[model samples]
Target: MWSTCSLARPPKQHPYENRGCLLNDDVSNLGKVLEATKQTLFSLDTGYVSLNRILCLFEVWKTFEAKSPSGLCVLMLDVAELFNTFDISLANATQPADMERIPREIEENIGSVQLNLRLKDALVTSADHKASNRHGPGKDT
Candidate 1:
C-alpha cells in the first residue's frame, strides 16, 4: 500500500516563482500566440534575406563584373579575412587613404594580389618527402 502526503507549509509566492514548477494546463489553446511568434521569427529571417540580396546587388554594381564570369568568381572569393595576408604598405600606396577606413573602392583595385606560394611549395616538398620515405633506405627487398 502507498500513502500521499500534503505540504506542511504553503509557499509565500506563486508556485511558478519556486525555481522550477510543474503545472498541468492546455497549451494547445496557445495556437494564436505561437502563430504570432512564428510570424515575428519569419519576418526577421526575411529581413536578413532582403539585406543579403541588397548586398549582392551592391557588389555586382561595384565590381562591374556582374555580367562577367570573373565577376562571379571574385564575388565568391569575398570571404572573411580574404586579404588578411595582404601587404599593408602596398595597400596604402595603391589606395592612398587614412590608415583607418581604407575605402572599399581602393580595396577592390589592389593590383597583383599575392598567392600562398610558400604553402604550395611546402605541400610539394611534403609530398616528395613521403614518396622518398616510402622507397626505404638501401633495401632491394
Candidate 2:
C-alpha cells in the first residue's frame, strides 16, 4: 500500500542535511520541477496572460476586507494530516522523467531566482557587518 507523509517541520538550514530524509526529497526536486512547469505552461503567450490575470485577482482579493459580524466573528478550521489518499494513476501521469532539467530551465528563463538569492545573501552580509560595526571597539557588556 502506498502512503504519503506531510512534512511537519520546515526545511533544514543545511542543504547537505537533506539527503537520506524523505521529507526533503520532494522539496529538493521542487526547484527543478517548478522551472520546468513554468517553461511548459508559459511557452504559449496565452498562458502568460492567464497567469497575469490570476495574479491580478489574487492581489485584489488579498487587500479585500469584510465587515465584522456583530461583536466579532470567529472562524475555525480543522488542521489534520491525512496520509495515503493520493491517486497513483494521477501521480504517475505527472511525474517528470528528468527532474534536474527543471532547475536548469528555470535558471535560463527566470533570472530573478539567481538575483533573489544574491539579494538575500547581500542582505544577510550587510546585516552582519552592521551588527559588528554597532559593537564598535571594546565595551563588553
Candidate 3:
C-alpha cells in the first residue's frame, strides 16, 4: 500500500506535476485514467481535437495501410551536408519526373519562356551548383 498519495489540483498552473499518484499494487488504475483521458479528448461533444490525437489516429490507420503499398514513389535524399559539392549545371539541366507536387510545380515554373524577363535574369544570376547524387564517399553499391 502507498504510505501517502497526493492529488495536485488546478492543473494548468502546475501542468507537469498534477498527474495523480497511486499505490504500486493499484497501478492498474493508470490504464483506467488513460482510457478516460482518451474518451474525454476524443468525445465529439467536446468539439476539440489536438494535433497529437490526430497524429495518433493517422498512425493507427497507417499500420493497416502499411501491409499494402500505396504505389506512390518516394525519394528521400540526404545530401544536405554536401552543399558545397553541388553540380549546378546538372541541376539546371535536370528533367524531373513530376510524380510529386513540389517537383511538378518546380518543373512547370523553372524554365518557362513566358516568365517575366527580369525574373528570368534573376533566376540565372542566383543559380547555384547542386552536388551530384553519385560518387559519394561510401563504397559503390
Best by TM-score: 2
Greater TM-score among 1 and 3 belongs to 1
Error of 3 at 136 (Å): 37
Error of 1 at 23 (Å): 43
Q: What is the lDDT of residue 74 in candidate 3?
A: 16
**Estimated TM-score per prediction?**
0.19, 0.22, 0.14
84: Cα error in model 3, Å: 5.6
Clash tally, candidates in order: 0, 1, 6
The collision pairs in model 2 are: 32-103
Query: Candidate 2 lDDT (Cα, whole model)?
Result: 0.26
Model 3 worst lDDT run, 10 consecutive residues: 42-51
Residues 2-113 of candidate 1 have per-residue lDDT tens digits of: 1111111123443443433222231122222333321111111212221122222222222222122122212121222322442222322111122223234324553222
Residues 74-127 of candidate 2: C-alpha lDDT, one tens digit per residue:
111211111122111111101132223333333464343442333233334444
Pairs with steric clashes in candidate 3: 86-130, 86-131, 87-130, 87-131, 88-129, 88-130
Give per-model CA RMSD: 26.3, 20.9, 24.5
